[model samples]
Target: MPFVDIRLAGNATREQKAAIVADVTRSLVERLGKPPAAVQVVISEVSTENYGAGGQLVADRAPVPKMGEDANAAVTSR
Candidate 1:
């Protein structure tokens, strides 16, 4: 049996997660000769507020738009 663990700083769509699981299982099956049913995969999504880097939380690293400001403008200007 093989165990795989994946952690993401943000969320993923259901379809994206499903594809990831399928791809990981396929890889283990092909590379390690493990049966698909014997392979285990776990996906964890950590909120930006809960994850930190460079002495700051991920949520705080991105600029939030002020009132009446365009959200895209804040991201592109950075």
Candidate 2:
């Protein structure tokens, strides 16, 4: 059995959560030869304020990036 623990900050949609579980199960099945039923995926959600980055806590802020923006542009360009 393969255990995968995912710690995410803030909220996510139900669809997003479901996708995560499915993807994790697939990864374990592919990488470790574990069956989908034998893979364990746990998700822990915490406040961004409790999760610090760059020595600063992420406050209640959500800057919705444009559809075309890449991840680098989304963070560094802010």
Candidate 3:
């Protein structure tokens, strides 16, 4: 089984999150030969105030996430 945990700086719309889950599941199925039904995706959204980068809070340094942007760019993957 493959599990993908996603963290974002702000809330994501239902459609946005569905796209991510589908994309991740497809990637795992194609790369690792995992079954779609066996893959699991988790999403966690944190307030921008709780996330910081380069010694500055993300909310102060960048705009809120929009569709087609790298909202999960700071995520940890292994």
Best by lDDT: 1
lDDT of each: 0.94, 0.82, 0.86
* Clash count for each candidate, listed in order shown: 0, 0, 0
Judging by lDDT, tell me the better candidate of 1 and 2.
1
Give one digit per residue, the lDDT tens place, for model 2 in 1-78: 788899887788889999999998998789889888999888988888788777767764545566887756767766
- Scanning candidate 2 in windows of ten residues, the lowest lDDT window is 57-66
1-78, model 1: which lDDT tens digit per residue?
A: 899999988789999999999999999999999999999999999999999999999988877787999999999998
Model 2, runs deviating above 4 Å: 60-67, 70-78
Expressed as tens digits, the lDDT of each residue in 5-71 for candidate 3 is 9999878999999999999999999999999999999999999999898999887774545477576
State the displacement of the C-alpha of residue 24, model 1, in Å, after optimal TM-score superposition: 0.5
In model 3, what lDDT does residue 8 have? Answer: 93
Cand. 2 TM to true fold:
0.74
Alpha-carbon RMSD to native, per candidate: 6.2, 3.8, 8.6
Which has the better TM-score: candidate 2, or candidate 3?
Answer: 3
